[model samples]
Target chain A: MSKSIFYHAGCPVCISAEHDIVSLIGAENVEIVHLGDNPGSIEKAEKSGVKSVPALVTPQGNVLHINFGASMEDLK
Target chain B: MSKSIFYHAGCPVCISAEHDIVSLIGAENVEIVHLGDNPGSIEKAEKSGVKSVPALVTPQGNVLHINFGASMEDLK
Candidate 1:
């Protein structure tokens, strides 16, 4: 499986989506990063042009889950 | 049909969950309240003992969808 990064901001939605993301992307395959606690998270998100949390950074360099919940079908 | 209130905070997850909620609770049955835009939203939420958004106040006086996505099964 390709690398998938899940960035979260400790919001209720982010908290809720964490389980779904792990279930869809596989816990081992996804590097869960808490934007509020992780160092350089803001900088990284800004650099990547990510405007929101609960965002998924796919191996293809596509950022998703910025506007909606990450559907299992969409993740796969 | 009962009065079901959906409280949201304009978060991406909240934005995404809106449709799911409407589908589960029926559009006419659910009143969508944006916490940031609506007057007295904060006060109402506080009075209701709501700490977060994406919350569903059921007619039964149960508050759901505060921590997770509003599942159709759960709502029904």
Candidate 2:
């Protein structure tokens, strides 16, 4: 299983997205990182060019900017 | 009992925040509005000046911009 890290900055949307991602990818596979609060997450998020909160970083180091929109259908 | 409508645009953060708000406020008191998909939400969001996702609208018509940061403490 590929490991995923979710980088966020405390936005409510980020909080909400965390649930969907966990539901979609399983909690065991995903790590929730709050950039402003978590140590080292700020640098990591910066490296990924995360301009917004609730970005998803996949195992391949691909950062997905999920700032647009999501649905139950999108998650499933 | 107050009605809260969560306006979002499918961002992961918004999704994650939705879970927290529900847990904090109870699902019965909250309504999730997807501005991109839900009819009339876009107009409402625009009127509310929601430039970002994961905004919360209270029964009093107060718009809360949850774009910066949130913690478990902030929610509780």
Candidate 3:
């Protein structure tokens, strides 16, 4: 299993956050899921405790809302 | 939050399992997600470690493969 899950909405921040997370954890170590690719994913991610994009599901099962420091304006 | 998540595919087993799980946990206590309702959900569920429908995601984050005793033939 991947060490963490990165949820993004394909926004500017999300895309850049994905790149940074992938760079930090290596591509294979993290699972990247696009909320923008599927609208239903947003619901699923929220149900999983994610408030918005650029979020990370930590290995400890906690949703780390790294939402670009509350830059919700950039999220789609 | 719901006590658990029930993944169904609108199959005979899945429908019955949903009923049973709901009966056991009450409708308001469990969140039911139908994999057949949205094609994209199948991929999401698989990524969540759900091998097939009629599966259950436990509160502890464990995917219980209660796939109707593996009677996959009935799954759509």
TM-score of 2: 0.43
Q: Score the docking of each candidate (DockQ).
A: 0.03, 0.03, 0.01
Q: Which stretches of candidate 1 lie over 4 Å from their true place?
A: A1-76, B68-76
Instruction: List lDDT for all candidates, in order.
Output: 0.60, 0.61, 0.61
lDDT of 1 at A15: 72
Error of 2 at A64 (Å): 0.8
Which parts of model 3 have CA positions greater than 4 angstroms off? Answer: A69-76, B1-76
| Candidate 3 per-residue lDDT over residues B1-76, each given as its tens digit | 4367778878776776666556444587678887656666666667667766677666555564542423233333
Q: Summing lDDT over every window of 10 consecutive residues in candidate 1 chain B, give the lowest-scoring window.
A: B67-76
lDDT of 1 by residue, B1-76 (tens): 4667888777777776666556433588778998667746667655665555677666655454443433332222
After superposing candidate 2 on the true structure, give the runs of residues whose Cα lies further than 4 Å from its correct spot: A68-76, B1-76
Task: State the local distance difference test value for candidate 2.
Answer: 0.61
RMSD of each: 12.0, 12.3, 15.6
Model 3 DockQ reads: 0.01
Residue B30, candidate 3: C-alpha displacement in angstroms: 40
